[model samples]
Target chain A: MSEDKREMFDEQDDGKVKESRRDFLKKIGVAAAATAAVPAATAKAVSIAETLQSHFELMSDEQKQKAIARLEKRYSEQFGKQTTVANTPAPDGVLFGYALNISKCIGCRRCVEACVRENNQSRDPKIQWIRVLRMNRGNLTFDPKHLNEGKPSSDPLGNYGIQSGGHADKAVGISGEAEHYYNPEQVPEENAFYFPVQCQQCEDPACTRACPVRATYRDPNGIVVIDYNWCIGCRMCQLACPYWARRFNWSEPVLPNEDMNPKTHYLGNRPRMVGVMEKCTFCLQRVRDGRYPACVEACPVGARKFGNLLDPESEVRKVLATKQVFRFKEDFNTEPKFFYYMD
Target chain B: MAEEQMVSVGRRKGQDEVIADKRVFLKRAAAALGVVAAAGLTGTAVIQSARKVGGTNARARCAEEDVRQQQIMVGKQLLLMTEGEKQQMLDRILSSHSRKVS
Candidate 1:
């Protein structure tokens, strides 16, 4: 019996040892499998992470969601506020008109500088919005003094009788045999006038009509405007303009880091993107808000007159009706809003 | 002879119970180790991914801010006063006082 008992205990112990060994092997097997799976899972997670960090333009839809979520959380934390930015359409019903006083205008180029800053024009050294065309009144032969009455005349063209067609209605001179001494000191004389030229803002603007894609059009206020986003840089409008007012952004406008205008209107003088056509919007932003155009407001000489042409009480209308206004290239019938007048 | 009989009976009955207990203990240890390892690995992956996403988002926000800054500068610089901007630079000079036209 004793021998049998000892044998039974030995048998039980051997069985237990066998089962424990099997359990140990199984546990090790499970651990090894888990270790193998970890690396693959880690690699997958890393690749997904890399995709989320890619640029917004390159992100796929799934990645984009991840990216946007991250951005939203970050922005909220950084700004401590929530804000969404969107593009809004420009306001309507703004008309612009400008008149230059040839009689009072001196040949100073101050209007040029003021216009540059006001319009946020390209800083191209050659880009000037206002061009001072100096010519002699009597001498149509492009005499600088006859046109530039602002300065003392070395060779005043007034002596030549070039502007004097001798017609009594349009004529201003001592028409007899007496020598009319052309005085350089005296201004507002029939002998001298200076004209500054810019976009005509014509009623029948040829530029708008010539655009193939309708990228350019006359706004409700009669101001000609160009949509840069729609423009294909065909340069057709530039050729159609009689005044040579439109300019193409040959390259992206090279603006200084500090010189970009953010409050941009599509039609107004915004910092246009590359390969687009741009022209004066007649300071539409200001005009729509019941303010004078930028160029008009900058002229210290008060030479520029601006107001609604339709409003009888407006200064522009009054000046057009009473003053002896003459439109440039009237024969073409552009009916330009801009005009020149003597003091 | 009697002793041998008792030993065989005892071994037969206890063998199955001891084997079962030993197997259960070993299995429980292995399962606990696996659960802990998986949890650690997954948690680490999640943290790494979140960090990468956050960094990219910060860079994009910086670029947008740069654009806004540029626009503000241009607008302020180009703001010409209405009265001064008019084509009256010369007009003001000539009209400073009434001039006698010859």
Candidate 2:
């Protein structure tokens, strides 16, 4: 063993140890230099830092040009292609509107899953783009069942018999006696309806008001938009929203590569970064580009309707005119483009 | 006036040298770290972080056959659910929504 070790050590020697050391150091230097040849991170970091410092609109002409260039460069590195942020033109004489049929909505949340996969939504439990509220019929006063039915209710038998009031003394006041009055048999009732909620895309948006930087705004087509590069991640818009439609990405999204929709829309379902607030842009990317929203496609029941409200020929306008519609939080005067019709 | 002038000149010279040195140091460090980070060493550390940010999603480690397999989560417990139940749930949602559109 010792003879073999000696032979290995001798092979590393190049007539003299000092000469070999020099050669070894040279090899390391060459490898490191080759690695460094790729422009290291000097330019990328500087551009990203510059983006952080500037108010997008306040930026000088030169800075604006730099920002556009930086965005193009960064997106290419992250997504393997140079992404162009194109100006999506609205159809002539078009105004977007959405309607949901409450009677047709089942507690099963297929739309929610479809929206998440489409929008490249974050995996955080709090980051759901759509929420399905399950409410029991005839429970006018305390609607414990009306609570956010995000994940299916805990197995009603194993965990069901326990009343909400019995869960805690504090729950008693909040849930009231109606919480304890739940019957296992009353579940899966025919009268139950699932209400899926997302950004109402209000005609007069509250979120737009909350953005101190005016990063978010309503475009001419009445769709609310957030300029991601301009967003400061202050989360003020979330607070201002009455319907709780806005979702903040505390961490990066976790989507499988196979499930990723390579087809992206800048204002709609494109992948967003951490610390940004995102909501349903009513699939503006799809609508403006003459495609349907992923949720609209995923609705097996065809409960969701999307079209232009301004065009007399549009289906959404026809639905609004013919059917009696209900808007959530109408008293708040958000003037939501979204409405619900009884099927 | 002469003393004040001398002091101001010395201070300006000292400040200029310090600023120049700091800028050089920053440039050198950025270059060095950037090279190391790009060799994927720094990025690997970020990838190790389970917390994902941006719109990027994680890749499924399981094979296609594995994806076809059904798994369920109840509270903290992991359970195997029947494929039939999953199909039923999906079918129920589709039928319910389809009925409302017309």
Best by TM-score: 2
> What ranges in model 1 sit over 4 Å off?
A1-94, A141-193, B1-102
TM-score, candidate 2, first chain: 0.68
What's candidate 1's DockQ score?
0.02
lDDT of 1: 0.55
lDDT of 1 by residue, A1-343 (tens): 6766776777787778778777876777676567646755653232345333643334477765664454334334433444221123334423456677665676565676766665566674234556655444433322322332432234241232333222434333222121112234544445444556678888778898889978888766667877665677898987787666776665334445355443434356555554677767777656766678777777768888987654557788577555645555544556567766544
Report the error of model 1 at residue A60, Å.
27
Q: What is the docking quality class of candidate 2?
A: incorrect
lDDT string, candidate 2, A1-343, tens digits: 6644654565455246547545755565566665554343522333546457565546777766666556555555666654554345566656677888766775466788888877767554335667765544422212244333322234321222212222333323132112211244543446454556778888768899999988888766678888776788898997788766777665555555556555665556666765677888877777888877878899888888998765657777676666646566555667677876654
For model 2, residues B1-72, the per-residue Cα lDDT tens digits are 699768756765785686568567656755665576467554444544543432233223212112221110
What is the overall TM-score of model 1 with all chains considered together? Answer: 0.48
